[model samples]
Target: MVFGTHRALDSLTLEVPPGITGLVGANGAGKTTFMSIVLGLRTPTNGSVSVLGLDPLRQGAELRANVGYGPERNVFPDDMPASDFVKHLAEVRGMPRSEARSRASDALWLVGLGEERFRALGTMSTGQRQRVKLAQAIAADPSLVLLDEPTDGLDPVQRDEMLALIRQISSEYQIDVMLSSHLLEEVERICDNVVALDAGQLVAQGPLRELVGDVEGVTVELTEIDDVPGSVESVVARLTAAGLRVTREPDANRMDVLGASADLIADAVRDAVADSSARVRRIEQRRRRLEDLFEVGAS
Candidate 1:
């Protein structure tokens, strides 16, 4: 619903249960807009949106009470201390002053920012600031949390830690979470459900494994081809004759056989070795990742 006159979203619809759902897309893919709509920060130009059984547009206040939001962009008062900021946010959400302070400490500790609680927000590193934002969002113990690019500006170690924290929050805390990200690997690692958008349109949406399905392919590594040209041609001919879509990567000394099973790959390898002294160093059957699905679906 967080769309514009340019129509950043095209009638996108999805249902998220009490678990982590990853919303993914390339840049300008409307992921942020979709999260904004769900958070009641942006109203849809056309479709209706409900969060926790309440209309986000009309019941925004009530909806927001149970929803925690961590935006992709940086948002914090530079002069305020991390603890003060989180405590203030908790109190603003209707928690008692004493309870808010305790909850703020707990949230900061949960995000590994306990020692930095008293540090000025401006003095903290980008990763620390990001943690502060996340802590504030969850300090109120909301039922659902929306995180947009939560690992941005983090190093490899920090990214891993943040992902682990997110996983814990969803699993141990039992909070329903929806995260928007472009990193396909991260989504594949942590998300149970995925809703993919491209150029402001919903392209794919389903459970991760179901969306990927069985589009795995086999990579054949060839060797010992005295007559490279002829041997490769013959190999391709034999595979195609067997009704497989073969894509040759000449530079890599490998060919991908699509829509083929393990037995087929083994058979092709055997035939290559017998018919032409060609050696198959390796026959690897790899399941396609989410990125592969995106590329295939996009094409």
Candidate 2:
């Protein structure tokens, strides 16, 4: 997508299916702009996008009818009550008044706002307001839903609750979801597929597990360190000399020995203890995290 003269998305391409797909990136990384183009809210400057086999720019209304969107920012009318606003949106989408009211109530209940359905939107907490936004998105029973930072501005508890709700929507409702988030942990928890972007360019896109394959390594934490940097450097130098890729973490106390066999890591640990007076608190193999893939992809 282009915003004036600058390209926000460059030759982006991806395929989404029936499961949850995560769009992850840093802020201003074109995540939102990509979603906008797919939803037909913004047009791409160069490449084409087809959602559910329909060109969004050519069939905007038809595509949107089957695709729901929860925007990143608050766009609700605070003056209206929560139920009223949702019911109005449903009706605008061609639902009958009675059916719209019923669907709105059901949607609110689905999003865990059953007790607060009558509350004014202005008085609702940020988390509650977020739920209302989600409710509206799913009220129309679209097959595909786009959630943009659904848990943004929420407390840890609220964020967990919202994540659980999203999981239920994907599993119980049997709906395909395209969730956009800057938080890797959140996406790791809820998404089956991931598409990562950086600086308006595509980085990686695949099943979350496949994208982060089995690349196990070892992490060594030491205590009684005199000079943290010096100890780490000495250990890394020795490991490298022994033909191992030793990465000293930004915080120098911990070092990750990569692509080394378990026995080699054990030998290196033994050498580190023998050479220095540093107390070895822990040394064990660590499974790679989704954050690791993100870091590697970003670099």
Candidate 3:
């Protein structure tokens, strides 16, 4: 999609399957524009979008009726109580006013805001307000939810709760979720798939396991071993002479073996440790994470 003369998102084509899918990118990679298009808030310039099997450009209203959007911005009315605001939006989506009010109560309760549903949003904590936004999104019982920076401005504890809630929204509630965030670790924790964008183009998109793939090296830990005499320096020296590239992390009591098979690295670690009089405590492959793929990685 083009924004005036600048191409904000180009040649980006993909699908969101069941479960939680993470959309991660740098600041200007068009994550928000993509969400806007899917939400029918913005029309794409060149391509068409199929959100839950509906064309967003043409069937915008029908699309919005079934799709929920938890935007990053704080757009709620401070004077209004939380439940009233959520119920009003559901009413806009064609629910009867009475039904909307009931659904809004249920939604607020689901998001742990039942007690504060009647409270004015202006007086709520950031975390509580964030949950209110989430309740508003799912108030109409959307088939799909697009969450933009769902954990933004949350403290560590609140961030964890929101992330777990997002997981529940997808797993327990059976809602297909497209989570847009720059937090790679949060994505790794909850998402089944990952869509990575760079410079307005899709750089990678696939299941998390498929996207990260496997590492080319192995890591060995000696920290748990007891009564060993040798230092990491001696172990590294022994492994180096044995024709293996080893990166010694003395502070962590571990060593990374590069350019070798897992079996080979494990055997080498055992031999090197034996020679150095220390014992190998643990051995495992050094797996790559989603953040490693981005030039300017996710936060």
> Against the true structure, whose lDDT is highest?
3
Clashing pairs in 3: 1-9
Where's the lowest-lDDT run of ten residues in candidate 2?
Answer: 224-233
Model 3 agreement with the true structure over 1-299: per-residue lDDT tens digits: 78779998888889877889999987898899888888887877876789888988789889899988888997678889999999999998788999999999999999999888999999899999889989988998889998999999999999999998899898888989998999898899889999998778887888998777578888787743456544566678777887889876446677778867888878888887777777668888887788777843433
lDDT per residue as tens, model 1, 259-294 = 667777668667865676566787777566777767
Q: Write the per-residue lDDT of candidate 2 for residues 21-72, one digit (tens) a residue.
A: 9999999889888888888988777777889889999998888888878899
Candidate 3 is scored at a TM of: 0.84
lDDT rank, highest first? 3, 2, 1
- Whole-structure CA lDDT of model 1: 0.83
Each candidate's root-mean-square deviation in Å?
2.7, 2.5, 4.4
Candidate 1 residues lying further than 4 Å off, grouped into runs, are 1-5, 213-217, 221-227, 242-255, 258-260, 273-282
Which candidate do you rate higher for lDDT, 2 or 3? 3
Model 2 stretches with alpha carbons more than 4 Å out = 227-230, 241-243, 249-251
Q: What is the C-alpha lDDT of each candidate?
A: 0.83, 0.84, 0.85
Global lDDT for candidate 3? 0.85
Stronger candidate by TM-score (1 vs 3): 1
